[model samples]
Target: MILPIVAYGNPILRKVGHDIDENYPNLDKLIEDMWETMYASNGVGLAAPQVGRDIRLFVMDSAQIFSNMDEKDKEEENYPDAPGIKQVFINAHIIEEHGDDWAYNEGCLSIPKIREDIYRAEEVTLEYLDQNFKKHTRTFNGVTARIILHEYDHIDGKLFIDYLSPLKRKLLKRKLDDISKGNIKVDYKMSFSK
Candidate 1:
């Protein structure tokens, strides 16, 4: 099942997600649905908040980014290794972020047709639980880390647009309002503000 992604002005997107344990109802099903919804919408990452669930959970598949990059592009971007990561993160926390900030054009399923250049640390160390409730600490970099950071923001009640400058945000205000009102067409299912 592909759940309807919550639109930009939805209050749920601003709510901090709560941590959930293994016993959470329909855990596997929810993750599966998120994956389906994300892929259907051409997204590399999807957080619980995007699907109207205020839980600290997200899924990411950075393989597409890895596969799309040519050898020359990887070398030029200093992306020597592509982790090709595909995993679930539950109750995730960023332990540290280091290295120079790099700018990446970021977008969200919840805020379709909006992409902005966001600068983020090149690497991030995170602590999270996997699908089976197994705990792990991992470090990620390059495109993989970028995707994680984007989704991680969702659980923290932050959006990529929040990182933009006041002027930039103001410029996008009308488009954002249109999204909230369902004035734009999107290929995937979306729940808009009434």
Candidate 2:
């Protein structure tokens, strides 16, 4: 099933998600639907908050980014974590962030048509549970790290737009408002706040 993505201005997006355990209802089904929804929406990552669920869960597939890139581009932009990872993250927490900050144009399914350059650490070490409630600690770098960071923010009541400067945010006010009120066109299903 393809769930409607919660739009910007939704209160659920601002609420910190609670951790879920293995016994959470229909955990397997929700994970499956999230993957379907993400692919349908052309998104590399989707958090529970995006689907109106306040839970510390998200799915990411940075491998898609690499597969879509040509060999030349891949060679020039060498990301050691290339051909990235596809996995589910439950009760995720960032243990540490390393390396200098780099800027990347980031966007969210919740805030469609809005992409901004956000500066984030080049690498991140995370502790998270997998689909089967198996615990794992992993470090990610480059685009993969960025993707994880973005989705991780959603669970913590943060948005990529929150990283923007005051002036930049002010400039995007109208577009942001439009998105909240369902005034824009998006190919995938979205539930607007207004």
Candidate 3:
């Protein structure tokens, strides 16, 4: 099943997600659906909040980013974590963030047609559980880290647009409003607040 992504201005996106346990209803099914929804929406990551579920869960496949890159570009951009990872995260927490911040043009499925250069740390150490409730603590770098951080924010009630400057956000107010009111076109399914 391809879940409908919650659009910007949805109150669920602004609420901090709660942690879930193994016994959570239909955990496997939900995770599977998330993967299907993410692929259908052509997104690298999707958080539970994005699908209108306030739970500390997200699915990411940074590997897709590298696989889509041209051979020449891949050679030039020798990211250590290139060819990244495809995994599910549950009850995730960032233990630490390392390295200087780098700017990347980031976009969200919920806030379609809006991309912005967001600055984030180059590396991150995270502690999270897998689909089976098995715990793992891992460190990620480069694009992989960025992807994790982006989805992590969603679980914490934060959005990439929140990192923008006040003036920049003001300039995009109209466009943002349009998204909230379903005045935009997106290939995948989305649920608007209004």
RMSD of each: 1.1, 0.6, 0.6
lDDT of each: 0.93, 0.96, 0.96
Where model 1 places Cα greater than 4 Å from the true spot, the runs are none
Question: Model 3, range 85-187, lDDT digits (tens) per residue?
Answer: 9999999999999999999999999999999999999999999999888999999999999999999999999999999999999999999999999999999
lDDT minimum window of 10 residues, candidate 2: 74-83
Q: How does candidate 2 score on lDDT?
A: 0.96
In candidate 1 the C-alpha lDDT for residue 165 amounts to 96
> 45-153 in candidate 2: lDDT tens per residue?
9999999899999999999999999989988887889879999999999999999999999999999999989999999999999998899999999999999999999
Question: Whose lDDT is higher: candidate 1's or candidate 3's?
Answer: 3
User: Candidate 2 clashing pairs?
Assistant: none
Q: Write the per-residue lDDT of candidate 1 for residues 1-194, one digit (tens) a residue.
A: 98999999999999999999999999999999999999999899999999989999999999978787788877776673374789999999999998999899998989999999999998899999999999999999888899999999999999999999999999999999999999999999999989
| TM-score for each of the candidates | 0.96, 0.99, 0.99
lDDT (Cα) of model 1: 0.93
In TM-score terms, candidate 1 sits at 0.96
- Candidate 3 at residue 32, lDDT? 97
